[model samples]
Target chain A: MTDHRPDAGQPVTAVGEVRAGGSPDGGRLDYGGPWRRVSRKYVGVVVAESIVTGVVLAGISLFFALVIGAWFGWWMLGASVLVTVVLLVVAPRRARAIGFQLRDDDLLFRQGIMFFRIVAVPYGRMQLIDINRGPLARVLGLSDLKFVTAAASTGVSIPGLPAAEADKLRDRLVALAESRRSGL
Target chain B: MSEAGGGGAQRPVAPAAVRRAVEQLTDGKWHRLHWASPLLKGGIAFIAILAFVLANLRERLVELVIGQTGGPAGPGGGGRGGGGGGDAGRTFNGDPISAIYETGFTGVAILIVIGVLLLAVALFAVAWRMHSFRIGADAVEVRSGVVFRHNRQARLDRIQGIHITRPLFARLFGAARIELNVAGQDAKVELSYLGSRQVDELRRELLRRASGVQRAEAAAAVVAATTRSSAPLSAAGTSAGVVGAAPAATTSSPAEQSREAGILNRRVQELLGPELDLDAAPPESVVKISPLRLIGSLVVSEFTLVLLLVVAALFFSTFVLHRYFILFLLLPSVLGSLGYYVRRFSKAARYSIAATSDGVRVGFGLLSTSNDTLPPGRIHAIEVTQPILWRPMGWWMIRINRAGHASGRGGSSAPHTLLLPVGRLADVEKVLALLLPGLAGADTQGLVMEGLVARGRAASGFSRAPRRAQWLRPFSWGRTGLARTDDAVLLRTGFFWRRLTVLPLARLQSVRVSQGPVRRMLDIAELHFNTIAGPVRAELGVIDRRAAVAVFTEVSAAAVEALRADGSHRWAS
Candidate 1:
């Protein structure tokens, strides 16, 4: 048999380089293919959510100020503003951190800049592949690909893929899962 | 609805199936348990409710006495018979004591309490009458329920094993509950409230049937073996000669007779209908935990360490903080941990593991003994762990994950999933031999220890995390590694309490490769092998990216090969 050992001593290759070397059509298996970023509009959703929360907190603070006292209200408002600013700064970085890759027999999902997590769901173990479009995602023409596996811990939710691509991915994954599972 | 009405011609077949099922449930010497079985089963709940009611009554009576003694002309006494209807007036007027007795509330409460007791007794009787179990030729059927009848049948072929459980009250009554662990679905057939003798015989009969022994043949074989053993050799020889003289006179062949005699000598089991002596030769004992060792294990556990920490903190507080307040706060937790340790590991005091024909049997418990049979190929994964403190003593704990109802963290306390609570390296080897018999004679012990608690890397054919990965793990990077065999992949990690997870190639559900920014900085990635949801979770963190990729490819390939070889998805049996 031919040796299939990976070159472990080699310098790590950049993800961008790996992606650039892969076929643009995304139809064939590209070993260590480039990571696919979620839709940029997801950052907008985050910003919108932050703004809503900020507004709610400001309203509550205003109510407390009118009904109770000014010191507590002003403190609450200041805290809300601080939180809103922090969220605005972090949202885009988090959105950029989300990425997924489809391999020959499994789907890989990686998320989080800090407390990072990477999950892979084997095609054969895939019990359900669902496409969910929230109101914001629908407005942005994006959907989330949810892969449910036999192992609860291995479930993956890839958010912010274009609607058409999500549908195609779901169909392909369902078909692959069925064909692979049929062997068992 | 349309299908039901449209299939009218098939209606007769449905009823016939039902009739067959009913006959199967009630046929061939159905047995009822002792009359006190229900009382023993539901006694706890009944007593709890009765106690609550009596307490409330006592509190009311105490208040009445205090009020009457304090002042007869008090506000409550004067307004007694004032307003409301006849029942209310009777409740308020007359002597305060008489009024209290005449009140509808107390009367209604008493009546309702009595009524509930009566209903419970009646229902228990009905349930007792309705519940009857019978061992059939091919399956064991249990019929129960009064209104919407329930008839459950577990086919012998599909049964995984028979688990006998004796709760505290059941143990008091010398009764046990038998649960048939079936292969597919969550529907388990249970025959509860059986005498110990009956439980043993029924378990044996069911297991025999599960092994494809026909009931009639087993019964006849039992009879023939008993007679031969009881009779003199001369009589036996004459009977054998008579049988040989007329071959057609006996239904059993000579080969069968010889096999029966051999089985009788080996097993010597007595099958007297639904009751039998369990004194037959038991399965070979692999390990029996000593009480001292068990207590030692518990004392050296993480809980005990925390308890010790709190006690030390209490001592330090006397000098440093100069207040005993912290001790008060920590006392409850210390006591709680003590209680938890006692309750949890107390059942494991008498832990014993034995090897059966097709699987392993574990028996343990102090007050309520539990006997569980783990059939071959049911264990999805295994974990052999060594806490830091346990390493000095060379102690190991073996846990397994099987495909069934998920038992959360509480499952660790259960004896069924715990192959070994605490054992030496030799004991661990014995358990591994029983669990992974195919891997025996190989360097399994070396592989397990090297992958789990080894201080060095690369000595046991393991692929270790890179040196640079120490930034993430700090204390444990050198110890974390993965080892692969033809049948299993072992992943080991952790510094304080080391964990080694073994996932069978056939049971792997998925493989994940993940890298964070920090891991990317070190050129390493984490690999996770996901099996069915259970205790044994396998994840190799912070390995070289290339090695992760190789593992991902190799494990996926092995999984596919295993699928091709077996082509069966059921993980348990």
Candidate 2:
């Protein structure tokens, strides 16, 4: 088997290298450990959502075809089929792009494909760290971790982490937040 | 400080002192306001109604004059009422000229007018008597009611500010209303219809006591009393004794003794007395906004842009509708915007920001002047904005979020929050220096300018969005960046209206890094620095993913270090 070390061969950008201990080395910064992706079953969740959307679109199209004419129905069916195919192809890729990194003082969340976004929420600034489980997520044993800060604009919700991992992160964040909040 | 102490000591102890103090502090013995207060409160409404009645009578009175001049003596006609009989034969609008002889209508109208005047006078008298306020050692209580009594007390330490407002009519009478804004309280403790001079003295005294100096002295007195006497005095007794003794101690000076008598003598002629020049002693001027710039800012503002659109619509309507009726429809809105601009700009005209020993003082206004003194260490956050249009002129507006009592509503219209309405970039630096004196260092000015106008990747230690990310924000991608100093995090964004947000590390409540689907494809992120609800909201958009992570970690760590170094949270204190 090939040797596997998470930190051994990660790409380092000119901006900074991600170090574990959060110490500044020269002009470099510590961007915490390697990002941990959400559960693989999150792909199943995305596929289910896309399927439901496709079914809804098809049903609307079938109604239009039956009530109006067969030609309109055929047009809507083609459109719905095209949309479903796109979702089927794109859902897994989209799910893979979402990842989060827990640092010494803050949590860094990165997501999206074309319009990439990375959000960092400091532990000290967290007013609330909530865990939410939807019906599908509950069935799949996955949950979302939400971070609420004092600022209205800076809230973050990280979806599709395993239930166990979500709980552990919630507890860790709460403990860190408590210790750091005394200064504020 | 010595003058305050001297003035306090020489205050009279008998009629003026004991009576005024007791009336200001206790509910047992209340005092009525100046007798003219009734007329002052409701006189205008009474006069208006009376004028309406008189106007209605004008036509009938005129006809009576003409009838007496031309008609012959007739039945129901007495001395000064008789006129030529032939003239009385004429009719006005088919009504007989005898309609003017209707005494019943005239008598009833006169009686109704008199009755309305009496009711207005009585209502004012009742309102004047119902409202009374008492000043306690540590709190001011205002009690007012006719049938249902309402009482409110504001603690001296909790008092944030004292605003003296003189409406046009009040200014005519040299009367001003004192509104005491209390921290965390929605309602203000108002003392209305006080003589302008009394209002000034009362405001000064309240502010002085609120500053905690007098409270410390009172505590010392309590300690002395506790040690000297075996029997414990009641809470009210201790407070009353301290209140009476502290003023006496401060007012004992010989020079103040003469001034005390002069104040008492003037109190008798309060209404007719010269207006108390309400202006505060001007602080040393740092910057004065010129009228030309003030008007120019207003003309180029977004409000004026809307006005221009309306004018264009009006012009366009002339060709389409073939009439200028649209002008009638849009005239009010155009006039309204013009009036609003005039009022806002004219009030801000002669705006002068000054540096006081403790903080910055801002004074502005033409008709109703406002002088606001904001002590250092109380500001929550500061924002320096350069609108896209104002960018060419190199002008910036600096606004601050203060710690105590959020202004009643949103928007920059909130009084006292605006540090500079419009000023050059250099003026922004001066105001920021006064506001956050601790944050300035050798290269701060350069860093500040870079934060304001710098472009491209890594300009002045800023990590800008990569070129690949430019597709999403084509105009602003190069300009948007994040930079850090030892004490502050600067976030710059916007292409046309470039905004620079400076957040001191210690004041930061939280930091957030967020990414979306489009950003994920480009490997970019956004960094948001959360502060308490304040004017300065710091957010850097389209930062590279790696740099965003670095920013998140560094800013969080730096904030902790800054807080530790500062020891005390400025906002909390």
Candidate 3:
């Protein structure tokens, strides 16, 4: 009965009891209650990854231009710089778009701005919960939580949670999954 | 361990032969598979590797001939594979099989093959010795690998189904592969190359054991049903089943009773059975598609249309355009299509659907026959589709989704997934009854019929998409709808290819309602019923936003209730 998918352009509202790392208008995307946003530090990880990739691409183009005597090197350099700039610009919005809500019966996961997808994975059907952290994510103290279900296409993963929050959510989810363990 | 799963003391006593067979395994002693397990399982991979080695040897031999005849690096040299046309022509002469066969045991090819065979035997022998399985009260455990151990346990309560596969080569040795499918991503628990009879016996015993989880709540519900103003219909059915089960245990009617024999001398009715009753199956259960109709459907298909066009063009190029050269390139493709047509035809020749005591058996194939059992409630979803080509003939194809990868066969070109290739409306009804016993109700049957073909009936009881939603689905908007029954939900969609999907509530993993930018603008949404991966994509699109929310809540609640009441997970018990 709740308007779970409020418009992305809705004005910021008071988060009330929910505080998810200063996400703007996080309260507006509430499904009965406010959604929990991922850590904003995730933007840094994306930016850093983009910069490293850009440097590699620029170097490859430089090598071609200076060493291999290739004319397309200039075009390749332009493309890589344009891509890195676009990636840097969208990193924050992409992070903001990622949010999750833990309802009584199921955990709802949502991501993507242009082509959005919202998945509901029932607690009773959780098979396993895994926590993963890459070198960059680990440096930023962020963990990505993934849970498996009997269905191959459940595709439920929540990235960019602060380490402590990720651990707490895992514990709560494990308890919920076990207590209501309905075999597929 | 046996007591841990708790099938309750009042569990139905299995048939004596089945009980004895099960007892041998459930004693918790580890058992090794058949001696041929190594040879049969490794044969394919070994042959593949040998073929690769032999092909290389053959190429080297060809090169030697080329080097000797044409001398080193001739002026006409091309790619390494491009041996001079004359040398290559003399060797194969368009028949590769005969070229190999004619060579026989005359040369290094034979020696290399023999040596590889010996080494493979030695390695696989070790692998066979390493792999062992044990059946405990609650789980079937398998352990393999030498240095790096691989231990897998399939909980009996979580078993989806057990399937016996006899691949073409394995059948020559009267061997079968047993794969125990459970509900998880990495699901197979395989025991390869068991003797045919042993496989039958083992599969039966395994199913009975796996389906032994306790149903205390179900028993309580039955007792309550009988006592609280007894529901006459179910009470009668229960009493009748009880009466039948009683006589089954003490099988011999008093006068014919002989001295009780031990397990060693067990006789009269203890032979292992095949999955299908191909010989004496009743008329009602047997579904045989006529060859004429099969060919007719093929003629009307897109595949045949393409083939016809290719042939027509080939003829046009050869005659009208006076281009004989095109024949060389196009001739093989025509022949390949013909070969494909024959293969598809053979898949339908001996196809039969029969109901066995174990489950509904679907048997097909001409030479290396394969059939598997699907017990009641194992089916999660059923989809009946009518492609525009088959609409005139009123033919429908049925595909199903079960928990395991083994089940489902009804779509195009997937082995063991197509439940039915093509059938009439009445045939679909009969097959539906076999898969979903809950559809036996008259009301449910009516709903199914309406769902199948209710294009003009506005009052057909299905919740259709709003007229405004036609912005999305122009042609299919009138027919695309969602309906529900107590047992399952029916989602209808498609115009050019009509599809009706029925997903049981108990089988639903979760419920999701999604709205995209366009749908949000149109005040509509899409509802998806999450289920295990299979052919049936069970989702309803272009539904009104309000209805989507209402159905989402309703399904979530109903699914929870269905889970509480579902005893299908342990159907036999």
Instruction: Return the top candidate by lDDT.
Output: 3
Rank ordering of all candidates by DockQ, starting from the highest: 2, 1, 3
TM-score for each of the candidates: 0.66, 0.61, 0.70
Tens-digit lDDT track of model 1 for B1-573: 011112112133333333333333334556565556688678688689778767755655665666556745433333322222122222334444346445536556567769997998899999888877676767777788899898888766656556888777776656677788764445477766665544544565556555433433445565564354333222223222332333233344432332243223223333333232223335435677788888888888777777787788888996788898887887787777677777767678688776443346788888778888765455667898888888888899998876544354354223266779999977876667566642221455568855654565644677778888899988878778888887678777777777877777766777777666677667677778887666677887778776776777778777765544442222111
Q: What are the per-model DockQ values?
A: 0.19, 0.21, 0.19
True contacts kept of 1: 0.33
Q: Which stretches of candidate 2 lie over 4 Å from their true place?
A: A1-150, A156-184, B1-169, B175-280, B302-306, B316-332, B402-413, B438-446, B449-463, B532-536, B560-573
> Candidate 2: what lDDT?
0.60
The regions of model 1 sitting more than 4 angstroms off are A1-119, A128-131, A138-143, A160-184, B1-37, B46-118, B129-162, B180-190, B198-280, B315-329, B409-415, B438-446, B449-455, B567-573
> Comparing to the true complex, what docking class would candidate 2 get?
incorrect
Largest TM-score belongs to which candidate? 3
- Arranged by TM-score, best first: 3, 1, 2
What is the TM-score (0 to 1) of candidate 2? Answer: 0.61
In model 1, what lDDT does residue B73 have?
43
lDDT of 2 at B333: 78
Mind giving the per-residue lDDT tens digits that candidate 3 earns over B490-546? 888888899988888877877776767787677677778888788889988788766
